[model samples]
Target chain A: MKTLYVQGNTWLHRLSPGLKLGGLAVFSLLLFATRSPVVLAAAVFLAGAIHASMRFGVVRTWQQLRVILLSISILTVFTLLLNGPADALAVFLRLVALAVLAATITATTSTAEFIDTITAGARPLERIGLVKAADLGLAIGLVVRFVPEVLARYEAIRDAHRARGLKQRPLTLAVPLIIQTLRHADEIAAAIDARGIRGQNNRKLGEGS
Target chain B: MATRDLVLAALFAAIIVALGLVPPIMLGFIPVPITAQSLGVMLAGVILGAKRGGLAVLLVLVLVAIGLPVLSGGRGGLATFVLPTAGYLVGWFFAAVAIGYCSERFVGRSQSALVQVTGFFMAAMIGGVVILHGLGILWLAYGTGTGLSTAFLGDLAFIPGDILKAAIAALAGRAVMVGYPLLPQRA
Candidate 1:
């Protein structure tokens, strides 16, 4: 997985993950509420200014944004045909502002920090017994770890196919990948059970009751 | 959820992201691509059943919300939420729910093999195609201002690919049925 986090100790880095995430949400809301091209354009400028503040340099900033830029361009072009230039501009400006602002924060914030913030945010629900905040953290952690494992497994499966002289199609790739992972899932659940990681929640619930 | 179920959900979420590494075929008319990830969504539902399946999709969305580029084409962040494809992306959750629920209700330990395959196939179509496309088209038409008929026509491009995915999910569900029986046994 490509990480957006860059090495920096800027003020954006100093801010809490909650603040950054909250601002991102509110910032999106602001973009959604406005129709004026002026406001939209300014939002774009604001996003640009934030990126410039990073001093990631033009190359680095462009590197981060080029893919997003392509899709945004596609949408803008399509909208131009369907809805005319005005809506097209609106579409482009809004996506740029949102994507840039989002990319900036993500670059500054590490995945650990992001997951921690989400876990903290879900604390209230934990208190009400709707969920275990710790399990939320655990689940996110497991997913973050599992993505790479799945990829590695995919590579191994491809290798196995190569050695066996089998043609690799999408279905062939997927079937083995899924079955192997599901088998691992059984072991993983057993491992978790052995370690008592998830059981902590149930034990706590029983104590509370 | 049980430990096995949570781990299973997380595992499926990982599979969804991995499937995304397969390059999506972008349609000339529509903004969204023909992604392999949706096939992962169908598999999650068919294999994991409803509760765990929906949880898997939700976990991915949470990853998306924090701006991880887990979507096909390395696109993530709030930018994706505003994309014309956002409708389908969000629709993934409901699609998984619909498929998983139908899988649970339709297939059983004692069911005939034909019933098992047919049931899983029907679930995938209802969830992966009907439910997902219904929401996806509506959002494209209204949210993106593309209008209904044009958007509907443009979305027709996805049908052939999506049907193939539904079939694959059904067959895989059948293949793995005996090994992993997630369907409830009635308490």
Candidate 2:
């Protein structure tokens, strides 16, 4: 299972996670506000520079983005077929550039740093009875960690199905996958309990402690 | 404090965020862009239950709102919500809640794969698909100045894919229940 993060010691990697997160937020807003290909292209170039400076190989980035690139290609072709060449090009480039910039942020930042930043930023919301920031942070972390595992499990199950010569039946693959997933969830719940990790109350108690 | 649980939560959230990096595939016949985001939503609900599920989604949304671009097609920010897809984005919250509620209610504490799978499917379909599409289609109609019937037509393309996603969510949710039985339970 390939990790999404790129290991590097560049300026991007050196920046505080909070600052980088803040910057990314600001930039995303800018992207949403502007539909201009020129500005989008410029943002992409800057993102590329950051990635390059971190010594994350462009080829590796492309490899990670292969699915996205393929999707964009298909979408571009479809748009061209339905609409026109100019509109297709504009939408495709805008979408691709946005994706690349987002990926760069993920590749550069550590999961821990991102969570911390979010927790810190969410402090204000904690007062309104929306959620406890720490708990929210913890939950965020779990989703991040487990998504890949679920994907990997799906692949493993698919491979097992192939080995069993049940290649064409989707139900055969799906049933076992669901069954296995439940089993995994049960164990995880047990482990959490055994470790004595309480929910929101625990966080509050910890704060008191 | 169990550092492990904390670690696990962080890891799962990252997976959700990373999955968002996958671009949206435009279905030629449908207005909805096919993306892996619903998978993330389903996983969050299954793994974290209602409260944590909602939290996990909010985390990703925060990243997107702050400009991290953790959304399908790498789109992010407040402006993304204003787009035609904004309704779907907002619907993720209720979807998680729906999934979490059904999983806990139907599956109980047994963690039986059958029950878990059934519960998850129910939740995903009700929350992620039915309710989500309901909100999304309405928003699409309102935003584009199209009639409800036209909006329904545009939304039809998503039904097949959304059903497939519901199936996947069922399987994935069950797996999580089995593998990580220590997941926080409602009192």
> Please, what are the lDDT tens digits per residue for candidate 2 over residues B1-187?
3333344444545556655654453434545655666777876676666765665576677655443446655555433543445678887877877777766677665556676688778878887788889988887555434457766876897788888778777776676556555545552
Which whole-number lDDT from 0 to 100 does residue B152 have in model 2? 80
Model 2 chain A worst lDDT window (10 residues): A167-176
Best by lDDT: 1
lDDT of each: 0.81, 0.62
Alpha-carbon shift of residue A146 in model 1 (angstroms): 2.7
Ten-residue region with minimum lDDT total, candidate 1 chain B:
B178-187
- List the candidate 1 regions with Cα displacement exceeding 4 Å: A199-209, B22-35, B179-187
What global local distance difference test value does model 1 have?
0.81
Q: Calculate the i-RMS of every candidate, to one decimal place.
A: 4.1, 8.3
User: What CAPRI-style quality would you assign to candidate 1?
Assistant: acceptable
